[model samples]
Structures are given as structure tokens and as C-alpha cells.
Target chain A: MTVQATLKAPGEKLIRIRLELEAHEVREAAISGDFFIHPEESVSILEEALLGRPGTQEKLLKRLQDTVELGGLELVGISAESIASCALKAYENRKGPGKA
Target chain B: MEEWRLIIDRPGRGTYNMAVDLSILNSLARQACPPTLRLYSWYPPAITIGYFQRLEEEVRINKCRAAGVDVIRRVTGGGAVFHDRELTYSVFIPLSHSLALPSIRESYGLLCSPIVECLKSYGLNAHFSPVNDVLTGGAKLSGSAQTRRNGVLLQHGTLLVGADTELMFSLLNVSKEKSVAAAEGSPEGRVTSLSALLGELVLDGEFQTDLSMRLANAFAEGLGCVFVQAELSEAERREALEIEEGLFKREEWNRDRSIRPAFGAAGD
Candidate 1:
């Protein structure tokens, strides 16, 4: 089953995450939010970067950091750390049955 | 005291207004000009989306076009703003300027202090609300956005003088929560204009000129700058026109390249 989690942080901005975790690989991730970023197009690039990456804390953080560094994305109210945490939080909160 | 060029521009088309701000910012970046502040208005009124905001999501395009309201994109990051019934100002300065703090948030607080003082001068109890807005009577009176490039920073803001709240909200794609709040009371109802506060709409010409002079004086005192009135130079005008015709007026720069804005729970 696809898992979805929505998190609102710092009061004003909200980020919702939906993805599938298969054999330790994050797949089909879709992240959307109401936040401002300089070079606004960078969000699409960040969304694309999350695909097929490991959903673990270290891997997620590295992925997010790398995305910002590569794209020079400046998130005004949202942080990559928040995004990473949401991913992990959603994964843990997944409604699907655990793999055998 | 530092010398700052001050331009009290005639009302202009939205495209030209944005282009002029960018032109001055670029000139400052190149050290081709000194720091400056421009106070201006929109002709035909406009809705400008933040750099990261989606065009279709932020505005009601057909409604905007039908009303002849031009919709443009800003280089600065902020929520969508309806630019009618407002006094707009843009300040351009080098990043190394004492007022331009290295931290964006700190810079916003320091820069917005002048605007707060401007409102306070009018006998309104105004104060900075942090991150980039000025509030009066516990509601927002002005909001500013910032963008930095090439060692220069440009901060632009809109100060509400009056508005057609119904028309303004009709032009925006307000979120469900804000919509609900609006049903009870317009989410934007929190936004109060000087005219609204004063109980009658002031004559546009008189109000504009008066507000401009007061803000100019407040800014001069706050920033320790001597305001020298000046018009746009040939080079700056040429650049602004180029941007006006080529970029701000183009779909690729204005519409097709926008991101959707997220909605909050009647806030932000």
C-alpha cells in the first residue's frame, strides 16, 4: 500500500510526502509543499533527486544536502532536514503490512 | 552621511515597474550606480507571484485578464501579492553595505524597521513582525521580499493604502482553510489599509504624494542617507525597457516557468 504523510512545520509551511519503500530503496516519491525557494524550479529538481534513493536518515540527509548544493536551491521557509525527516516519518508510519 | 538616489516614479505598468527595480539592482551590482530607493505604483493594478510560486496556482488568470489586471512574476521569493491599492518601494544596495546583514532574516528586520517607523510617523503603532513584514494594530501593513545576486541585494515591498478586498481575493487562489476563514470573515480581512483605518478613501493623488514624502524622510533618517531626487538615467532606462519588453513581458519568464504555491491554515 502507498503511504502518505503530511507535516506542517514552523506553523506556516506544510510538506506532504507519498512514496513506496521496497527492499530498502525509496521509490516513486512525490513531495509537494507550500514553500518559497529561490530559483523556484529547483523544487522539481529536488523531487526528482529523491527517486530510488535510500530512505534511511543518513542517505536521505545526504541526498537532500547534495540536491541543494548541486542546484544552489535556497529554501525560504522549508528545510531539507524537514523534508528528510518527513520521508522517514512517513516510511515508519506506512500503513502497509511489513515485508515477510 | 551616505548618499542615496531617490525616485518618486509616476505610476507604471507592472512589467516596467519590475524591470526598473531589476535594472537598478543590476547597476548597483556592477557598481555603476549608488544605492537607491524608488517609490512607485502600478498602472492597471497587478498581481505578482513570488519567484518560487506557480502562476496558475497563485492567480485567477481569466479573472485577472478580464479585469485588465496584469499578472507578473517577481525575482524575489514571497507569497503572491495583489499590487493594487498599495504603495510600493524597492531599495537596492551592495551586500557589503552595513545595513545589508549577512543573514537574510536579520537584514529583513533591520531594513523593515524604517518602514515600521514610516507607519508610526503617521501615528499608527507599527512594528516589524520578523522575516520581512511590518504590522500595525496587530495586522500586517506591509510585506517585503528580497533577492540577492552578484553581491547586491534588492528588497521590494508593498504597503497597503487601500484595497478592494473582494476583488483582491477573487484574483487569488486562496487555500481551503483561508477560504473557510474568509467565509466566516475574509482571511485577508486581517489586512487593513490606511484608508480603511481612517474610515474614508483618501484622494489617490494626495495620498500617494504624501505617503511618498513621509517614507522618504523616514528612510533617510533611519538609513543615515541624504536623499537626492533623481530620475532614471539613460543606461538604467534602456536596461529597464529591455527587461520590460524581453523578460517581464514574456511567458517563458512570467508564466510557463512558475511553481505552485502551497496553502496554509489561514496564515502565511
Candidate 2:
């Protein structure tokens, strides 16, 4: 099933996420935010790396950290940690309309 | 140290403005142009999203069109900005230029120092708010973006003279809480303008009265670089037109991947 969520962390970037879960991990995902990232083209690259990762903050953080450490991406106005957290927030929000 | 070529331009549409900046950037990259500083305004106002931003997520299409606000993408990376009642400046210099510095973070502070000083010339205390914002009295007075490519760096920013909180907030998406704050007056509650800060300093509240000349002079003094007043060369104008037609005018180019996959894409 397709899932979606929106998040705005005060003093932080605003993110909107959509995903299709496959076997618990993400099958397809799109992450768009008001944040700025250098090399602007690496946005999709980072998103691609996030796909198929577990839909949890810890797992996503580890994955994001690794991808960033690879040295191809440089994010501004936001960070990998925030992205990971926002991704989890999106996932969790999608799971429960009443809870989030 | 070379004297910078300073060009003051009248208000223009978003596409043409971006095209000129990019053209200057390209020329600087090739060493075919001298280090330059441009001061310009936007006609009918406009919204320029960061280079990587997904336009639909950041802007309200109907609101932008209804208000006659032009929408275009910047060659630099930053958040969406409402370019109204603002003095927008762009600087193009080689990476090896003395002011270029060794790091992007350092360069932002280095480049924006001129803005801070310019605000100071107005007798307002402005300081560089790390990462890339200029602030005074704890309120943001300016914000900037940068792009480094082809051995050159381009930095551009806007200093608010008179901000229309309602129009800007209307064309942008914000969190519910922030939206409420904006409705109350002032988006984010942290942005202020020269007019607002200097309520009685000038007779004209718009702050556009001789604002451009004041900024140009302040910037020249602050950067310690002399400005040789110049107009766009024929080559620059031609290049800008080429870029305007080839990229900025194309809907597909401006709206790339801005929409959610399920909902598809739409535009101005």
C-alpha cells in the first residue's frame, strides 16, 4: 500500500514524503523538502540509497550516514540526521492518522 | 585586487533575471568576464526556488499567478524566496579570488559581510547569522545562496526593504503552526525589513526610494572594491536570452520532479 506523510520541524526544513512499502522496507520513495542541498543533483541519489532500507529512524540514520560518508552529497539547511528522522516520522505518520 | 564591474539593473521578469546571473556565472567560470557585482530588482515581484527545490512543494501556483508573481529556479541552492521590495545582489568570482576563501561556509561569511555592512550604513546593526543569513536585532535582514562550479563561485542574496508578509505567505507552504504565525503577521516571526526597522527614518515606507544607489555604494565600500559602472555587454545579453529561452521558459525544466508521483505535475 502507498503511504504518505508531511513534517515541518520548527527552525528546520519542511519535508513531505511518499512511499510504497515492500516487505516492510520501502519499495519506492520520494522525499521533497524546502531544504537546500549542494550538487542539487545528488538529491535523487540520496533518495535512491534510502529506498529498500528499514522504515525506522535508527536504520535510516545508519543508511543515511553511510551514504553521506561516501562523500557525494552535501546538504544545507538540513542534515542527514534530520532527513532520517523525518523519513521515520513520515513512515510512522502514515501508519496512524490518529496517532501523529 | 581588481575593481569589480558593477551593474545596476531595473526591474525585470524572473526568467531574465536568473538568465543574467547564470550567464555571468558561466562567463566568470571561463575567465572571459571580470569579477562582477550585480544589483537588480524584480518586476511584479517573483519567487525563485533553490536549484534543487521541487517547485510545487514550495509554491502555490494559483496564488503566484493570481498575484502576477513570476516563478523561476535559481542557479544557486537555497529555499524558496519571495523577491519583492528587496535589493537582490549577485557576485561572481573565481575560486582563486582573494575573497573566495577555501571553504563554502567561510565564503558565505566573507561574501555576506558586505550585506551586513550595507545594513549598518543604514545605521542598523546587522551581523552574519551562520550557514547563510544576515540578521539584525535578532531578526533576519538578508539571506543568501551559493553555487561553486567550473572553478568559480557565485553568491546571491536578497536584503528586504519592504516585505509583504501576506503575499509571500500566501504563495508559500508552511507548517500549520507557522502558517498561523504568518497569518498573525510576519512569516516565521523572525524576518524584518529595513522599512519596518526604520519606521521614521525615511518618508517613503517602501524603502525603494534611492535604496538601490545606497546599497551599491555601501557594498563597494564594504568589500573594499571599487566599482566601474557598466552595462550588460552584448555577449552577456545574448547569453542571457539564450538561457532564458532554453531553460527558464520551459515548464518541464522548471517543474522537474516537483510533484508527488501519485498526483503528477502541474505548473504556472
Candidate 3:
């Protein structure tokens, strides 16, 4: 199932996440928004790093932080915590068998 | 005072404009060109979307094509902007320069000070809104975005001389009703043009040239630099053509946000 989430934190720009999930794992992810990230390519790197990860906020946050440190990315108006929160929201909002 | 090259460019298409800026940035990074301040305008007009923005979600392509407006993606990150009735300025400063601030947020404020100064000179009480915007009278008057490469930083911004709220809203994928509200200066609308603030419908070539001159003076004074009138070198022009072909003018690059540049990540 594919689910999406949009988040606009108080001091950050809007971030929209599209998560493709199967069996409680992230198959693919696409992140887009008006936020600024230096070297710009770090965005694609972030998305690629999310592939095959567990669809949980804590794990996603760790992965995102690792990617940021390894990539030396400077994110303005957005952060790893916000991104993970949005991604997890998408996973929880998935309207598949997990729904009540 | 430090000397910086100043180029007053005539109106140009969006692809050529973006290509020229990127080419100049590369030149500065290579230490092949002096720090430069370029003032320019768009000829047929265009909308430039931010680097991370989804093009289809932000723009109406068919409507733009029907209206003869060009759309391109900027390397800098910000909201999409409609380029018309505005004076655009780009400043390229190598990190070696004494004026280059060490942090991105501070650099935006430093680079944008001149715009606020110019607006203040016009008696508008304009101020710099951090993270890249200038506001006056509770509405935005100018917005800027930045990209760094190698050891150089490039910041470009637009100062609106007039506003075409109707046509701008039509081309953008935004609520139609906001256009009327914008013209009326409703609280929901946050854009204000020079003409609107000054209570004059000033859209003449002479006015543009005057505005450009005033801005150039303001930048020189604010940055503690002297402007030496100059033009792009032949080699730089050639590089711009290459960039136009390789990046800015490509349909795939314009439409797809994920298309990486062949030259690799900037600043790497």
C-alpha cells in the first residue's frame, strides 16, 4: 500500500512524504517540498537510504541522521525528526489490512 | 574598498538567465572570475520553481505555454516565483572574500541587506525577513535563494516593481480568488510591489534602469565594495551555453526534480 503524509512544523517548511510499503517495510520513499538543502543531491540520497528500512519513526530517524552526517548535508527549514514523523504518519495512515 | 565586477544585463529568456548565473558561479569557484554582481530582467517572463518542488504540482504547464511563459527550475530552494515587472540581482562571492559570512542564515541576511536598504531609501520601512525574504508594510517585497559551489556562494533575488496578480495566479496552481484579494492587499495576501507601496504605477524602462542603479549603489555601500562596470568574458558565455544545453533547457530536468546534473553535486 502507498500512503502519503504532509507536515508543516512551526518553524520549518512544508515536507510531503510518499511511502510505498509492503509487509511493514518501506519499499520506496519520495520526499519533496520547498525546504532548502545544500548540495541538493542529498535529497535523492536521503530517499535512496530509506529503501528497505523498517516503517517505524525511531528507525527512520536514525537512518536519516546517519545519512545526513555521512552526506554532510545542511538542511534549512526541515530536519530529520520532522521527516521521520511525517513518514511514520504515512505508514500509520495506510488504509490497508492494518486499518480498523 | 574591494572591487567587484558589475554587469547590467538586458532582458533574457529564463533558460539563458539561469544558465548565465550558474556559469558565473562556476567561474567564481574556479577563481577565474572576480566577484560579480549582475542585474537583469526577464524578456518573455517566466516562473522559476524551487529545486525540491514538484513542478506539476506548482505550475500549470499548458496555461504557461498558451500564454507564452517559460518555466524552469532553480538550483536554489524556495517557493516558486513568477518573474515579471521585477528587477533580479545575483551576487557571486568566493568564500575567500572577506564579506562572505560563514553560515547560511547569516549569509542570507548579509546578502539581502542591500535590498532592505534600497527599500528604506524609498521610504517604505522595509526589513529583512530571515531565511531569505524582505518584507515591508507587512507584505513581502523581495525574496532570495542561495547555492554554494566549491568555495563560492551565489545569491539571487527579485525586487518587484509591479505586480500582475491575475496573470501570475492564473499561471500558478493556486487559488484563483486569492488573486483578487492580493490586489486589494487583503491580510490573506502577503505580496506587495514597489508600485503598490509607493502608490504609483511605475513600469517604464527609465524607472527600471533607475531602480537598478539605485540597487547597485546600495549593494556597493552595504558590502563596502566598489563596482567596476564589466561584461561576461567569451569563455564564460560559452560555458553558459553549455549549461543551458546540459541543464536549464532540458525538459527532463525542468519537469523531474530528481534529475542529477552531469557535472555532479554542486559544492562537492
Candidate 4:
């Protein structure tokens, strides 16, 4: 099932996350926002990196952090933690056969 | 005094305008051109969403099409902007320049100083707000966006001469409550135009020319540089055309924000 969550983290631009979750795993993910990220293409890379990752906060946050570090991405008004939190929020909001 | 190119462009289509800016940035990055300041307007009027924004979430495409308005995506990241009844200015500088500070907030403040000065000349008490906004009396009068790549910085912003809040709201994805508020005068009661502030219509060739000159002078004084009026070189024009065709005009780039050209993407 697909779920979406929007966040306006303090001192950051609005971030909207959409995730397709199945069995508590992220099957697909798309992130969009007004936040600034250097090497802007890294945004697409980060989105692509989310696929098949376990939709837990810790796993998602670790994956995002590793991706940012590996890519040397500079986020001006957003952060990996914020994005991971947003993705987790989407997962928590998911509606599916097994999900509450 | 240091010298810069001052390009006063005639109103052009959205794609062409964006193409010219990117072309200039690319040239400067390659050390093929001097620093530049370009002042321009939109032909059909347009909406430019920031790089990170999703078009489907930010703009009402069918509404814009019916109104003969163009929708383009900017290389810089920021909130979406409506380019109607506004003069847009862009400045390109190498990172080694004194004005291009290492800190993003500091750089924005320095680059926006000219805009604040220009508004102050018209008797408005304007000030630069952090991250890329110019404000007067707590209402936003101008907003800017920036991108740095290959040790070059390009910052562009808009100065509103007039506004059609209802039309703007129709083209953007905003709530009915905000649209109604905008109809009363300004968008969300937070935007004010030069015409509204000056208590007269500021739309005319003479006024535009005067405003452009004033902005150029302000930039020259603020940056400690002199500007020589010039047209885009043949090479730059050709590059702009290339970008217009290869990047700006492409559906994959504009609507989907995919398929970026090497020179068009932003990075440190």
C-alpha cells in the first residue's frame, strides 16, 4: 500500500514523502520538497537508495546517513534525519491488510 | 574598479530567459566570461518552481495552459514564484569574489543588498531577510534563489511592480481561503508590489528602464564594481539556444525534473 506524509521540520523547508510499503518494507519511495541540496541530483540518488530497505526508523535513518556521507551531499535546509523521520511517518500512516 | 557585464534583456519567453541565465553561469564557470548582472521580464508570464519542488504538487498545469501561461522549473531551490508584472534580476560571480562568501546565509545577504537599496530609493523601507527574501513593512516584496557550481555562484530574484493575486492563485495550488485572501489585494496578505506601495501604476517602458538602471547602479555601488552595457555574445547566445532546446524546453526536465544537462545541474 502507498502512504504519504508531509513535514515542516523546524527551521527547514517543507518535505513531502511518498512510500509504497509492503510487509513493513519500503517497496518504492519518492521525496519532494522546497529544500536545497547541493549536487541536486543526489536527491534522485537518495530516493533510489530507499527501495527495498526495511521501513524502520533506525534502518531508514542509517541508510540515509550512509548515502549522504558516501555521496558527500550538502543539504542546506534539510537533513538525512529529517528525511528518515518523514519516511517513518509515512510508514506509520500506511494503510494495508496487516497494518493497523 | 572591477568591471561586470550589464545585460538589459527585452521580455523573452520563460525557457529562453532561463536558458540565458544558465548559459551565462556555465560560461563564467569555465572562465570564459566576466561577472554579469541580467535584468529581464517574462513574455507570456510564467510560474517557476524551485529545483526540488514537484510540479504536480506546486502548479495547476491545466489552468496555466488555458491562461496561456508558461510553467518552468528553476535550477535553484526555493518556493514557487509567479513571474507576472515583475522584473527579475540575476547576478553571476566567481566564488573567489569578495561578495561570494563561504556561508550561504552571508552570501545571500550580501547579494540581496542591491535589491534592498533599489527599493529604498523608491522610499520604501526595505530590508533583506535571511535565505533569500526582501521585505518591507513585514510583507515580502522580493524573493531570490541561488545555486553554486564549479566555484561559480548565480543568484536570481524578482522585484514585483504589480500583482494579480487572483490570477496567480488560480495557476498555483493554493487553498480557497488563501485565494480569497489574495483577492483582497496581496497573496496571503504577505506580498506587496511596487505599484501598490508607490500608490501608482509602475508599468511602462520608461519606468522599467528607470528601474533597471537604478538596480544596476545599486549593484555597482554595493559591490564596488562598474558595469558596461553589453549584449550576450554569439557564443553565449548559441549556448542559450542549445540549453533552451536540450534542457529548458524538454518535457522530461520541466515537468518531471529529470534529465538534467551536465552544465545545468547544481553542485559545489
Model 1 ranges off by over 4 Å: A1-8, A14-45, A53-59, A66-74, A85-100, B177-189, B258-268
Tens-digit lDDT track of model 3 for A48-70? 87778555678889999999999
Which is superior by TM-score, 1 or 2? 2
Whole-structure CA lDDT of model 3: 0.83
User: lDDT tens digits, residues B61-150, model 1?
Assistant: 999999999899887777788888788999988889888887787778878888888888778888887666787776677889987766
lDDT of 2 by residue, B67-139 (tens): 8887887767667889987889998888787778867778888888888877777888888977789988877
The 10-residue segment of model 4 chain B with minimum total lDDT is B180-189
Candidate 2 residue runs with Cα over 4 Å from true position: A6-11, A98-100, B177-189, B200-210, B257-268
Error in Å for residue B261 of model 4: 2.0
Give the root-mean-square deviation of each candidate in angstroms. 6.9, 5.4, 3.6, 3.7
The DockQ ranking, best first, is 2, 3, 4, 1
Q: What does candidate 4's lDDT look like per residue over B1-268, in tens digits? A: 9999999999999999999999999888877779999999998898898898889888899999999888888899887888988889999999898888877778889989999999989888999877678989878899988888777899999999889999998888853434455576542337888988886537554888889999999999999999999999888898899999998888898888768765734222
Report the Cα lDDT for residue B125, model 4: 99
Highest TM-score, which number? 3
* Share of native C-alpha contacts between chains A and B (below 8 angstroms) recovered by candidate 4: 0.47
All candidates in order of TM-score, best leading: 3, 4, 2, 1
**DockQ winner between candidates 1 and 4:** 4
- DockQ of each candidate's interface versus the true one? 0.26, 0.53, 0.50, 0.45
Model 4 residue B83 CA deviation in Å? 0.6
Q: Provide the clashing-pair count of each candidate structure.
A: 2, 0, 0, 0
